[model samples]
Target chain A: MPLIVKPTPAHPEPPAHKIMPAFATRFGPKLAGEVAATDRLVRVNALTALCDALSDPEQAHGCADAGVVETLNAHVSGGQDAPTRVLAAKALCGCARDARAARAMVDAATPAAIQGACLNDAEQDVRMHCYDALIRLGGGPRRGASSIVAAGYPKALVEKAEKESVGLQPRALDLLTSCLGNEQGLAEALDAGGIATCLSLLGSMEAAVRAAAGRCLAGLCFDMSAKDAAVEADAVDTLCALLEDPDLGARRAACAALVSVTTTDEGKRRMVPAEPRPRDAVAAIIALLAEPDAYLTTTACKLVANVAVHPKVRAQLREDKECLPAIDALIAGPGTDQDALVAQHARIAKDAVLWEP
Target chain B: MANSAYTHTTSPKPLLSKMKKTTYRAEDEENIITNNIMFDRRVVRGNTYAAQVVTHNTQREVERMRYESERTLRRDATCQRKERLAKPSTPPPAEGRAHIKAQTDTFLEELSDRPVESEAVTQTEAILDRPPSPLFIPSKTGVDKETDIPGGDLFDFDIEVKPILEVLVGKTLRVSMMEVMEEAELDAIQRRQMEFEQMRNAELVEVQRLDAEASRRFAEKQRRFTQETDRLRQQAELGQKVAARAFARSYLANLSELAFDQLEDSGHFVDPVEKEIQDSFIPWLFDSVVETTNNHISSSSCVDALIVDAIELASNLQSDVIKQIKQKERARVFAVEDAQEIKEAEGTAK
Candidate 1:
């Protein structure tokens, strides 16, 4: 017998918006009808079809308008078999891409349902789908984020990110980033060793995962303790190393994370190494000032301003040829030519770089 | 006529002296001059034309004439009635003096009956007017100049609206780009979720297959266990049977040989004569022969011993008999001789 290699499944192109009405009208009633079937196979089939249809945002929006989120919420909180529940959770996750559907899902207590299923179910696939759905559905609003925190989702996400497949790590990290939207979720994630997990994943071989981890670290560093922990873990050096990464996303995320890190005084001091180094963090941030992306340039300026508080970094800025010019150009740039926030932070960086202290 | 002319007002005083003093109280005056009699200024009489066109002086003259005529008639009637009383109680002292005294006294009485009055006679200065207020002089300090600038020169609408337009354009572009990015993100997440669903489905199938395989293996193990148990039990039973059979055969072999040997050794298979002799005749013949031999030998021994003893006794007896015979013969011979000698010896012995 020869080896049989399975081809990667091709993603379907979504139908045009004109057809969504008809698609929704056809699938909506069918889903509602079969979702309540006495036979498990019928319910599972219905859920699979719903999951497939929910992949298109237009279709998802139509389904939400047709009240499919409520039906899925029932299965999430029901005593259905793992496969059926998995399909329901997957469908809910896809539906969440539509903002209205996400809102509808949250209003339907889908987060609480997915949290329950994710926690209580013994099956890995079921738990994973529930996790995915919660990631898409839970941290949207303050109420849902609080509920997710109360359900201990951050700890579970951290654990899954730590132990699950590489494909799932970035998603879990992104969910953790969302969890950091609120203080309670941030505190919960921190208590669940989120800093360590994010810092460790910063060394991931996959650039996407590294970028996601960097983003999560950036979010986590909003807390004072997380900043201290990051500094203590030598994450400053690690992120500085990541500043040279080939992937722009990883670099941007690292830059954002470094910005968060530099908010604290210790992080500021850490930005300027005591010894001579090959790659200077301050110079790297100054170099980022010339990038065309306003967000990157803005974030880089913010990081520079934060670290320029240190006299050593200020001296380094004075020694560097391009730092002041770039910052001056940003400050002198016309309002129409540059982002307001970028110009504002560039002015702040200039002031800090030129300060005597 | 001369007396009348000389009668100065004493007569009028007499006519009034008889009259009762009817001083109107404030209340009575209000009652007598009721609102019906007192015309309201706002009331329009039926002859509106006459009321409206009537001059103030004419209306006053009419009112005065109507009251004056009534008063004159009432005064004349009272005067006529009091004419008798008009004569003084005493004749007038002198006409002129009486008239003078009467007029003076009437004037004093009238003065005494009048209400308290204050008369203010203001003598305004004739045409004493304040000098006309000095005419305000129109004075102008600064020159009034006006200049007209065209609306275009003041501001160009296009230029003025440029910054606003740029802001609007920038805001619109930013919002649209953000929307596009959001849409792409949603599409990406949707695609990822779909792929996850597929992977999850495959994993589900694989898990189910593994579960089925596990159950099948468990059933196979149970069947094998039962077969092994049955084989062990049969082996034990067969071993037990073999050991029992071998032990029984070994035990019965010695028993059968012992039985046959004992039967043959007990002499039940001997010949009839040998069997009879051995059983009864042998013992009988031996006992009889032994007894006869014993009897014969005893008799013969007894006879032989008796013969030898008799022979010896006979010899002794023969010898003794011989001696006795000889002695007897000798005694007889000797008796004859001894008779003679015995007679002698008997005689000697006696």
Candidate 2:
């Protein structure tokens, strides 16, 4: 008997678009022209290729020309065509990392339209692109301040700012916070129930909301009248409650707020309770250390450790045995000193134990 | 001896003359011998020599006279011996007859030893022995406790057989062995069996009805589910159509705005065709073309090099929007087709 063998045919090479840099570079300049011609289908294909090419930082700068900036700005200002305008907005934002392009986008009259498009566009992609543009516009010095103040951010955006600030494009809440910096704008936000809104956002289920609210409160805490308003509004209790928040960023913000509020002698004295009275605020910090989340636990430990050393607050700490086990458990666990705040607590706990008789 | 010999010859002649006078025949001689053989044999064997001589002389005459008798006796003895030899030996019939008679006598003796009751009385007793008492013993004490009477007291009076025997004589007698009261117990058992059978049949019918009802309910649920699914499918179709229309309008609007922006930037301004188109045409047109082209090919291509190059700058923007819409449509279509194929395959397999 004879054996028969079958040979496998060679696979064909994929089409040119499927190929890499060579085709991209070869066709890049031509595709850029096609994108400018307003041929919808051809422009989509070309821009898709261009975006791919722009992923490389070196290639990204090349795509950031004045013509591209003009096209993007035109689309952003263009009404009714949400899908195309959104795509253009996103590409412009991507290219806006370049200083010149970023400045050009800021100078363009369509920043408001882009911001509006982002907030209200029917297409999710277009709205997301508007968000991307806003983030880019607010990321830097030149247009960051002005564009943030000009963009009439929606309430939903502020709510989103509270929930997902980190995952959010950087400029979302930052822009809102920067807008709040203006006295008139701050007074308006407060007048428009912005204080209650911020307080409510601080208690949001989302960590980002708590973090953004905390950061906003920190900024607002600088003004003496704002501080008085915050204290009157019970902003301290809200911030202290956030010390047990699951998100690391929110917990860190709470710790920072506590540190800032206690920095002044008068601030410390005000936060401290009257003599022989229990400090519920200090107890709240001690309770936060019992949270299961490592970040919240560590932050709470540090806050308590700081409060424990205060002459006025020391008597309360010595009386509370609950603080001792949590301190011991934190020091016994791995990575106790990994975080600076946790390390500070460890040091304070060591001193507190050492100074005991 | 000579004188006797001469005399014997002369005597024979004289004897012949004498025989002629009485003519003794063979038949007659045989008869005489048959009659005297028993005594003649004894006389011949008992005589001495002298007596034998005298007897011999006498015997000669007698023998001559009784020769037939002697011959007949010898022949009879020979026949008896031959007959005895022919038959096998057996006990006598008289002994067997005696034994039968003794057996009959013993049977009669035993019969006599029985109580001397009359035949009618025995017959009545046999009949009475067959029927059990209708009354039952109330307890293990063997007393009719319900009546406060001992069981033995029930049959205390003697039964007279004489008058009954006279009445029964020459009449046909019937003896029944059946227990009379057992018939009622049999009837009760039969009634219980009928009731149990009725109950069993009713239960079977009820079970079948329940099964049918369950099947009906199951079919009803299936029909309801099918109707609900059809309603949902129609709603989903309407939603998709609306979404598509809105998307198309948005695409067209954006295109016009882009074109207007370009015209504004150009050194030479072109005349507008339609105000709506002028403001929204270029961007919308760009988005639509990109969406259409993207539906055909997902990968970036320079297949239509000239056309592709003309829209290269805006292609990424348009393609992003197109990709999202096309992806959603593709998933919907694929899911519908896959579900249809799966249902068809399952039907075929079943």
Candidate 3:
């Protein structure tokens, strides 16, 4: 293919108005040439570079005009090797980072279908890249699968998130945890079953799953609307139960999550049993004060403080008196088995109730 | 106003020289205005009016092709000499006095001669003050000293109007060009708005597609989770049944061993000699063969009979244990079969 065009010397420097079009014209055919190259290996290498180039937002902006995006669509669907297809998807991910680039790709191809092909790739690496790219394309982390499920980019895009392979679910949840930092991102996530997924993952045997879910729920619990949604999903009850996870990391995450929940009025009601129970949210964290893991114990203190923030939660803690004694046991130690941080957290938790603001 | 001026001048210009009788008779403003400046003024005015008139004509021609600047330029250049005949800017600043214009001399001569003929009928005073006679004429003696109208300088305003004319022309050209550029700018804004709309619509479509996909995936996952839970329950049930069957087997073996030990300890205690006698002497055979058989209540055969009874009891106990083992094995097989059937049915339902 003739990709290069010699400039007419009659006008060495075309006016500013014509420069973009001139480059836009050159861009399309060159990419098409690369796509049409009979040498598969060469095509793959060229496409990798092309995808890499387009990942640059500036290059992505120009890609659509140059027909680069359309050709890339062809490459992605062109029955390339696993690596080649994955690379093409990685490029799309770069483009998806920019609104304009994402629009361009959407203009010419079905992102769902492309992602599905990458997802179906038997290679774990291929699937991983496809997922990463999906997240960039606004399928952001925990909600990425849900977004893909809702917007079937592929003609037959399947929701395999339930059977989430290794490396996908944890990463997805972790991403969503951070996504919750922004209001809009959190709203989007909540709309996409983020609450339910977190609830489900809370019960998962995998510690990573439990941890990510806990972190995500922690963010979710901060918002009243999300908290209400979580309550409907029995989030407080689930998280309160999770405070006793054998895995210290999971226990710490659960503690953090419960902190957000118990801070809310409804959460406090659920955590403090209607009838005094020794194994409720308050009792659970009290038990954690005796734990050797300083982080877990500290996390437990945070939950205790958070729960104690609620008037009812505070009254219940004072009524049970189990929490105070547990905390007293932790602080009364002769500094041998007791972690100072744990002791500090225990004091803060105690003060959180006794020294009511 | 320029057109009105052009039309008004066109009507009276031809009649100026041919007018046979009167000078300024009509008192209409146009006529009085004409009469007031008719002679020295008219002569000067005539040349100057022609120059001004020429400017109006050329300006109209230029205005006609204002949008096509090249065309207007060509038209102006093509008619330059013709227009210059009347206009001032060609040799500029009204070369009026130096030329002393031949037409000006004739017009004044006609005016000077007109009263001589009219003097034959009218009063001498009438012809003297009639606008033409007293007008200063540059003669062999001196320049027209009686007239304040600068001979050619009357039209010197044309030179000043030259720069003004250039400014006007530039304005016309600029307005048309600016109009075109403004229109282009509007078009660009509209195009950008359209592109934005298209992109926004595309994004909306993408969002919708994602929404559907999320629904579909969640539904699938829900189904899978349910199926998995069912599958796990079935597996747990199967594991429990296997454990129960193993326990039953061990318990049955212990029961059989205990029953066998009880039978061994509870057996009749018969001496070897007594057991041999009972085997050798059947009760009926001893009664028939021995005439001297005393009627003893307790015979030696009694211990032997007890020994035989004990042997019989032990054999029956072993058979019963064997039968129980068989029953338990059958029950375990039936339980396993039930579990397998349940698993198969569940798999098919799935």
Candidate 4:
């Protein structure tokens, strides 16, 4: 006699996909399977636990390898409820923080889902997370903005950036900087007035905003046309003005940018505006060399190298003979990583000084 | 000065030139690892400065720089305010928006009033509805028109003689001579084309000879240009090196000359930025700096430079932390939005 059991049918289960084995012991099949479970509560519990486990840097890589990215992506991007989707996206965000995991998601379905949420999702938090996820993956804040600016010169984008929030504007300019990393990008940046916009932002009230603008300015100095544009925009004077700022971070960033601007012919010509004898920056920048700041010293040395290309600036530097011993001291000092950066620039600038005319 | 005892060495092989791998001295490495600020210039050259001197110089320099920058910022802000007061008041937002819309869309306004973007390219104008030509007699006559239309005379009348002459003489010598001359000279249009090709060939030969000479001249010019550029570059490099060293020396001199006060009783203004810098960045900076400078038990450091670097590092750290937190929050929000989308989709599926 066989006892027949009739199955009660109410909620139909999803078709099961082939399950991949979890590589790590802590997140074996049971936890992994729980994320894919049809039961909502079970999935949530598993996701939260896995997300917590991922907080430890030691476990991030292993979890990513355990195929958690795909499951998280599905939960985040698939037909999960708002709260569940939020939790899943948060967990995915944690994963995105780790570069390797971010890359894994990039190859998976995460980007499209994240982008979709950023664009179409009604919730502000959800839109924000999508933007964060994209940035974590080095795809920039707004991929559309990045790609649009990338497609041609950044004219409209720079104008659009001006009206945006302080944070978004800098990011947009930074996006322009990335776009300007190549020769073509340089051409495009020139077309977009990147130099002018960045120079304008150099005087921003916010230190963070100024730093971003300075960074973009530094990037633009790499190409000839852009360098020419920068010259026209009075970048040298503006950058030098920033060197005198009270904030050391902005000053250092400004000095770093000055290093690039001063490296070119146009940069040298514009080092001091066509003003009275030499510019005040020549002295202010020289003063920076004596400071203990590694970044400032490095850039100051490089700026001097560029400015010294002008005989007037060179004469000024020569008049102040102590720079020789100062640079010499840096070269012969105990070599730390910071020392290496300072010493390298100091050495190059020193040679430029020591070169017999 | 304490720096005099160090006996600075000049390696004819320029330091940091060409950016080769850095060669570190073993003693230097040991000093770094041990965090010992030896009396060595490389370890700590500013040990000569008295503690009082270091403090005085740092405080004085920071105050002066702060004062100068603040004064300038205030001046600029006030000037802007003054300008705003002088100008007419801006319209209210709703009115302003309406004004902007009107300005953009009103077609009857002066064309000059339209604000053109500097880099914007103009779209090419297109002809939408070109009319068909009545005399488009296509040149693609696959079959000879004379054979198809039996109308040789219609087109052949281009150089016809009178009908009376043709009937009276029936191909007289004068008429035959005119026809021979026309055939020999070729069509007037055809003759011009042949002449042009011949003239062009002669001109081309002459042009080729001139081009060869010009190319030689160009090559010479290029060589001179290259040589001149090289010379200028070399000179520029020399000047740059000189300037770099000079700037460093002057800077060090200024650092050394902090005469109890770098400012000669510079007038003071109210200090506001100082508090923000101290509260947010300076204390943490001192914490890290204590460790950085701690390595040198006996060695002394320049407080002026140290404070600046510490301040910079602290400022950068704060910026980095802020960015990190913002990123984290945004990532979470985006993920939730994506999940919500999925949820909506699922509901529809159900």
Q: By TM-score, who's the top model here? A: 1
For model 1, the stretches where C-alpha displacement exceeds 4 angstroms are: A1-30, A52-86, A98-104, A116-132, A139-141, A332-338, B1-350
lDDT by residue for model 1 (A1-357), tens: 212233334557653221222354565665556665657777777677667667666666667877778777777778777777788778877776567788777677676666666655666676667667666665444466666666677887787687766766777787777677667888888999999999889999999899989888887877768888999998899998888788877887888788777666688788777775688777677778898766668767767766776787888888899998998888776776446657877886787688772
Please provide, for model 1 over B228-260, each residue's C-alpha lDDT reduced to its tens digit, 9 standing for 90 to 100.
999999999999989988988897879867877
Candidate scoring better on TM-score of 2 and 4: 4
Interface RMSD for candidate number 3? 26.0
RMSD of candidate 3 to the truth, in angstroms, is 35.6
Clashing pairs in 1: B338-B342
User: Candidate 2: where are CA atoms >4 Å away?
Assistant: A1-33, A96-104, A107-113, A140-147, A150-174, A178-194, A205-208, A246-250, A258-284, A287-302, A305-312, A322-357, B1-350
TM-score of chain B of each: 0.26, 0.23, 0.28, 0.18
Ranking of predictions according to TM-score: 1, 4, 2, 3
TM-score of 2: 0.37
The residue-by-residue lDDT of candidate 3 on B1-350, one tens digit each, is 66541222223322222233343443332332222324432343323222433333344446544645675567668787687777665353464545333564535544344443322232233432443323233434211223233345334666778989999999989987876686587558644653343233323323333453476468779999999999999999999989988998887878866776776556444557766766765655786556434433235466557766766765575466445434544654767776566556446644
Worst 10-residue lDDT window, candidate 3 chain B: B5-14
RMSD, every candidate, angstroms: 39.6, 64.8, 35.6, 67.2
Candidate 3 lDDT:
0.59
TM-score of chain A of each: 0.80, 0.65, 0.59, 0.69
Error of 3 at A283 (Å): 6.5
